[model samples]
Target: MGLGRGLAIGTLAVGLLVTSETPALAGNGPAYKDSWRPVKVRVADLLGRMSLDDKLGQMMQAERLGVKSPADVTTGRLGSLLSGGSSQPTPNTPVTWADMYDGFQKAALATPLGIPLVYGVDAVHGHNGVYGATVFPHNIGLGASRDPRLVQKIGRATAEEVSGTGIDWDFAPCLCVARNDRWGRTYESFGEVPQLATEMSTVITGLQGTRLDQPGSVMATAKHYVGDGGTTGGVNEGNTEISEQELRAVHLPPFKAAVDRGVGSVMISYSSWNGVKMHAGSYLINDVLKKELGFKGIVVSDYNGVDKIDGKTGFTPEEVEASINAGIDMVMVPYNWQTFIDTLRTLVQQGRVPLSRIDDANRRILTKKFELGLFEHPLTDRRFLKTIGSKDHRDLALQAVRESQVLLKNDHHVLPLLKHGKIFVAGKNADDMGNQSGGWTVGWQGTSGPVIPGTTILQGIRSSSSKVTYAKDGTGIDQSYDVAVAVVGETPYAETKGDRPQGMGLDDTDLATLQKLKDSGVPTVVVLVSGRPLDIAAQVGDWAGLVESWLPGSEGAGVADVLFGDYNPTGKLPVTWMRSAGQQPINVGDGRPALFPFGYGLHYSRHW
Candidate 1:
């Protein structure tokens, strides 16, 4: 209702854009007659019709239920609402999600222009929203593919399912080129290569596909803007002490690729760069990225990134104004938008921010709304909403799961899991859906328990093999043992907490567990589910087989497909399994000596 008509861009290339005094807009009356126009024209018309409070509503985003009461949905100035991985609806069902989306849209639509409110979810892998949507490999697995087109295909598939659920935006394609393998988010990048990161930017293009105006496609956000992946000491929200030139050349390349692809939005990072918080870096945000890179898109703040920019951090609420003046168009307060609105309004009234600055941010966001044709088709097919995780999508996810499995070791003949022999499945992860999914599943750091409902490795093996038994300990190995699949890897974690494998391989507990199983006289097939390669060379030598499952999501059953002779494991390590954490940032392409070089996957045509 608010955007009036939609904004437009004729071709996929960023070059087809027409620069406006502000950003793109839809202008008044109808939607796109043609696909190349700024959204400002439409937004200006909508703004003219809206009350002061309504115009202010366009500035903030919150959780769907974060507002104190349902009435808060109509609070006029709230621009967007989101449900992070953990934030579930009251009923927490497909029906509930749709109802929430429609209800919020109705509130925003009730206003004069009927602008629909933007509803967001962390649909990192498939519509992880609808319980059973086929969750594919996390970004790390895709990184190993080294195939940008495949990443784009995955993005396109992700967008289709997400959009089917009545959501229009996705926070995806984290462009950070992981500098330190120890970072918890190491799996979230397209590996440590800047060029590969640049190529993966095409995922944004593929998500939206040929027409940005299409209903099936969703807007892709190039995220954690500059140098977030390079945090020193591998801590989340830590400082990146690289030079400006290094920042531009190394970290900024993928973002530039995103902008070039006509990416509608960019999420500012939470980390600092060169001892400066990225949230407050006016020169980089406004000058280098916006002006120099010629990026004509909406700049959004990361979850609470705006707060990190303070007077102590060299920027006041007023200077924060300078950030928006520089480039930021929206703030994702996530939990409390009212606080943000109060602060932003106070800054503007106190003359800390100029009218032009406010207009700049508003225009940039409104342009995207217009270009997306949101005003024209506010409601998606409710029928498809019921079709959340269809069989076809699950097939796609299964394929990705197989494609992502890397066979890291095979001493003589350690695998294919022997269809006839008894297989001992041992490890905490072997039976848990949550452990295999890793971080960013149903929760932010994901969680430990039966996360929605996905097949565990044990179940997959049982279904495939004639005989399979499981245990946290490999008990009774003497009677049934031919091979024991000691599944191990990182637990569900995000950012800092997950990154520290306590100087051990991810799921270092696996070492003791596997050793216990190995000591039981069972030839072990160690399967690691980690975001990055962990130094498990000793563990590798101890085992007859080793495999890196790289945070495989809902379709973990694919591991069984390859393990049980249905398919062959073809994935290679996207990163080197370092000798130790001290070998931080060591990669195959780095020309540095490593315990296990990158591209080190070895596939056996036939098993022993």
Candidate 2:
């Protein structure tokens, strides 16, 4: 009379008979499969039915490349799938994304237990991985806006786009309190201050909505845990050599705020804390984050985060044991996830990893899955697909772009560019959508050119004025031109590639372009398109006007709005502007003489 997993066959048969399309339709299924039952009870029942392979598979997150076909989801019993920065489906359309999600979901349903696989993507700046998805300003620009409500709205818009694709997880709101602007990922932070990061945690509420089961809601991730922002020499994945108190004060507040908002997951950092790798840090992951702070959500490892624990090429068994013991509920093996699955199974059987730990992890992961209603509605919710790059969302991005513009210098009141005057625009970045959007755009590190649809800074200026001429190298301008606008600064890069180890000065081409405009006798207004503040102290005084446009994403009109007096400049410095590259690690309380202090910004005296 009993079923295969020891459930009464008659009860199971009855539960199965009344189902709609999805497995747990209207909570009608076996006790483990029932949606209406308490999540804990369902989790327990599911745990009881899982074998070693099943449990291990539930903890492994593989890249799309690792899976040969959609059937791989059921064959490997995989729990999750992700697209790295450059990874996308062929023809890369919104329809393609939905098809991919449904295909994978169908494969997951074919598994013996019918557990759905959760899909995660780095929609860090407005579903950025998707083409034509209305790219918004990056985090540093949002930080300048100093508008949590605006950020929350962005989060909501992002959730709708992600939900339209049938993706359920977003690895976003990189909450590192960037102590050094030289750090490659500084743009990912809201600001250098703990308060800024904490306030912006409203994005979590935006992404997850009032409840996880809501129509447009997606699970948000608080990532690169702990001290990635405070790494020594601003090196990527380097050591953060700070005392415990300093670490707690500067970097921990945003995460706490995220937990307060009930974030569903926390991705562990690849960096180290005082020479100890964070992936193996048991105190922070288990004792502090899980117990003291009381984060009941899943703790996921960063992309191949465990590989660097032993300072080796590939991950090791010791690394696996250390990471798992440190309370990493899920491992992002990315490629070779099957090896991870096999190794973890071996570790459990050998008693290196206890079965109880495995059970606890599964309990947490499955609990979220059940709470999200993934069992009943595993396919794409196509209703929200129309929201992608909608006019309303782009308008919000424009407002964000306007608010994020910081007026560093407006000498002799030369700004508030007149709409009728003849203008000359120059610089490699002035007309490129990819340059303004910065890293994590169409590609991983982001390439230069028109990679996506959006208003370029040149386009914004052209739209506003009747007479506008553009030259790439600041040529074809004389006294006849009223002003010369030179958009010059760092191109695009993320993480390790963005770090400036030897020097943080402008490149030769940028310097040459600036010199041409400065020598032309016309008032030169410099619009810096960069991820972080560069060492421009030597030549900053030469320009009549200076504006910090921190990777303003798709909407360049926001910068033009401020320039034309349509919007007053209000953005403050998120990180201190360095006097020289020597002040690499300068901060607010550090007592170092800065070119521009943190939280400094200028406004037009005459309001429009």
Which of the numbered candidates is closest to the native, going by highest lDDT? 2
Candidate 2's C-alpha runs over 4 A off are 1-28
Which regions of candidate 1 fall more than 4 Å away from where they truly are?
Answer: 1-40, 47-53, 311-319, 506-509
Q: For candidate 1, lDDT tens digit of each residue in 1-608?
A: 32322333222212335445533433453333223343444555454455545655676778775787546767645777777777776665676766767777777777655666676777776666566566778888877666776777777778877776678788887888887887888888877768778877878977777777776777888888889888887778888988878888789889888988888788888888877777778888888888988888778887767767652432346646755665677777766677667666777778777656776676676677766777766666565654466676667777778878888777767677778888888887888887888777766888867886777777888888877878776656664578889888778888877666357554556767877787787788888877787767556678788878887777778889978767777776666667777778676567777766777777777645
Per-model C-alpha RMSD: 4.9, 3.6
TM-score list, all predictions? 0.90, 0.96
Overall lDDT per candidate, in order of appearance:
0.73, 0.89
TM-score top scorer: 2
What is the lDDT, from 0 to 100, of the residue 546 in candidate 1?
81
lDDT of 2 by residue, 1-608 (tens): 12334233323533544324544334435666666655665676677778989999999889887799988899999999998899889888888999999999999999999999999999999999888898988899889888999999999999999998899999997999888788899999988889999999999999999999999999999987898999988888999999999889889989999999999999999999999999999999999899989999999999999998999888888999999999999899889899888888889999999999998888889878987889889899999899988899999899999999999998888888988889999999899999999999967899899988999999999889989999999888788999889998989999999988888888899899888887889999999999998999998988999999999999999889988888989999888899999888898888999998989899998643
